[model samples]
Target: MTKPKLSTPAPVIEKVAIANRGEVAVRIVRACQELGLTSLLLHSEADRSSLAYRLADETLCIGPAEVGASYLNIEATIQGALSGGADALHPGFGFLSENADFAEACAQAGLVFVGPSPESLRLFGDKISAKDLVEKAGGPVIPGYQGQDQSLRTLLEKVEEIGYPVMVKAAAGGGGRGLKVIHRMDQAVEAIEAAQREGLSAFGSAQVFLEKYLAEAKHIEVQIFADHLGRVQHLFERECSIQRRHQKIIEEALSPSLSPTLREEITQVAVKIAEQAGYRGAGTIEFLLAPDNQFYFLEMNTRLQVEHPVTEMVLGVDLVKAQLLTAMGRSLNWQEAFHPRGHSIECRIYAEDPYRGGMPSTGVLGFCHWPQGPGRRFEVGFEKGDEITSYYDSMLAKVIVWDENRPRAIEKMKATLRDCVIFGLRTNIPFLLAMMEHPEFLSGQMTTGFVDKYFSRPLKEPSLTRSDRQLAEAVVKTLNREGLGGPRPRGPDGEAGPVPSPWGHSWRSGL
Candidate 1:
């Protein structure tokens, strides 16, 4: 299929309804403020206390705490937007960001969906269709079977043709869900069933396809933006090679591993595919770079990505603002030749136990504070007294840092993570800090398997040094006086730990 003829009329948007919640919604609200637009936050019962509510100009209750009833309910979302008198709706990253039906519904309702058209979403929303479009545009896609034959027999046959270790990927969704690797024929049927079920459950689609699994591959993606005027520009590439269970945990800009020639070729290919699909607004074209430097198109994300901040930090461009402009019918001011100014890294802060099998932990947050200063940005979604529920994603914030180059960026991230304090629960801070200092990570020699190679199992907490002890002592005293949740970290010697400032706790705190 070729790019569809673009003819959607652009409207003058004055208010944008943020159709999702959490950090991305918060970011979009700020972007709307900067662009002189009102932000209408569509939230659920679970997000009544979220900071997005305070930041947005107004709030509309969609449904209960469950995501399906609120965030993913298209009818409720459209009703809220229409009732709230919004001219446009921004779906952030997850939820209905890439739902093609939602995009079509918004257009029919006379509201601009701050994203690509329904056609673009349908073409690229499915992994199979996206691969076909990339191939039609002369982009390299990994050899695999994307035929309409989703039968168990045909899938097994395709696996046999592609050899063992083939990947079963959900054609209709992302976020690392509905993906399974079958190393042998014995695992094929089970993996396929599980992937299909998950695909249906998560994305409302049961279709799945197969792909060749590259054991040592780097997850790289290019940020592409296009206006309704047929202008396309790439903001450059981001290396999300550090991941766990196929979900990215850490991301960086200007990958240390990319050769200049290879980088240019892959990113241009990304733009090529975007034009082929008539892509607009903020979208990501993901590719997998093999060890030999041969990259293949993986899929296209038809909405804003979770790790877009790393690119913003390096390029000093607000992608959310740019997206707003494009949605408002403004042409892109993106230079044909854009140069990234600095190196940056983003560490996802999740409210989970990194030392205990990465289990999800939830409760009322205590004295939550983050580092502040130059080059340190903490994009968060919660406050001290807010409850952390299991209904949503575990990610609480992202600690992003920028510097002159990669080395300095790493060091800055280290300092920022050390200063962050989030009492009342265990977090992934220790795991992230250790991952940064890992020899492979420091040398920039990493792939998608970096986490599994070193963190196959839960890691034990590293012993705290003297400075760490002092920081912990200060945190304990502060929280104690505030009558917050969390106690002093106990030392290995049975004394109050003068140890690390936050993250691990002596016990899980309650509301």
Candidate 2:
């Protein structure tokens, strides 16, 4: 890796502490390695055997498996970094990534936080403040109420004024927590209460806001990066309309829905908002593109997003590396303009049963294979023999592929999904494939409500024939007797599975 030219004398950042888990942790570890920095993993007890734990230069057990005691514990993270002799801390994506208090704690502890400043986090952490910033920056905003009135009567009155089909969202929430769409007056109170409860539980704040819900809107976002000199650059936009429960599953760079004129306008608006907020490092400005092509500001994410790989693939830049350089007060040497080369698509592979309404599948992984080829990039967190527990997000990996066009990219992704393999647990591959084949998806006309509109139920499976069941039973018996080519069969489902072996158990067998 070529060292980026420095814009100013930098405080030496020799070591970095990763304060998250799963694939994002693996990503940070690799970035640290490429930058020739020592990587210390501050992990919970449950993640001791994770792949990131083995890849990092050092490891420290911060607390137990529970998030509040481990990943979300700000003081514990700071102390772990200090004890590990880390010069900086990288809170990847979730947990404390967007917590202003955590960032301030890192600064107070004399550790550089590899993200935007604490002030920036605070500005965007609350949805109300973020919306105000957008409005002050002249960015278009949806018609809604952001007042301080907390009474039910005031809220209900405000809801009536905003009309039916309003969106109730947590002021300090993301990733679909504390967000609800109230379709009618009868459902408004219940949805509001639910959003408040979720907000309090997930983000520690029950303050809620309302927005006019655009039922057919497309979810789009622009990526922005700012340097120490306050130079902000927009990295185009991504389409994240195909979502479930307001959380994105598939994201692609260079949205198919935007025209050149609209794209220019939206990206410029994003830059203006970031500049107005004094944002630094990596951030995202999300928006909703209505059917009439009018765009409105949604909210801002004050950290590196999970879907950043698609942007990296299209623009041919490493955002994580740029982030590190920015933290060190270095210039990115970015060009005056960036043109996306090709279409890139990323599918979030989750450990869930697609036929069971995306039920979480937890167990020891076995015989995992991610096919390698041109334009194929995989960020995986677990390997064979690692357990996939329910303590955290169920996403197992992110599969990204690039091609000259969207259609070709979609085809390549389908072929790639078909060639890939995983054992001992069900995955959402089938569901993703189904989504890829949908006409609306193929046409790139999917909206934010696509999943809820078309796939409200579990995928239906083909009825099994008697002969098929008999064959499956025979295979299971053979495997049971052979003991997976060992002296004794491995114990229960997740406790002891095949190790250092090529065998796999099929979930379709129903044994």
TM, every model? 0.90, 0.91
Reference-based lDDT, residue 109, model 1: 82
- Candidate 2: tens digits of C-alpha lDDT, residues 1-511: 2232222347689999999998999999999999999999999999986899989999999999988899989999999999999988899998999999888878777888999988999999988989998888899999998989977789899999999789999889998889999888899889999999988977788999999998899999999999867799999999999898888899999899999999999999999999998889999999999999999999999999999999999999999988888887888898889989989999999999989998999999998999999999999999999898888889999999999999999999999999889998999999999999999999999999899999989999766766765666566556656555322333333255444344555333333
- In model 1, the clashing pairs are 468-499, 469-498, 469-499
Q: What lDDT would candidate 1 get against the real structure?
A: 0.88
Worst 10 residues of 2 by lDDT: 485-494
Off by over 4 Å in 1: 1-10, 462-511
Per residue, candidate 1 scores C-alpha lDDT tens digits across 164-215 of 7899988896989999989999999999999999899889988999899998
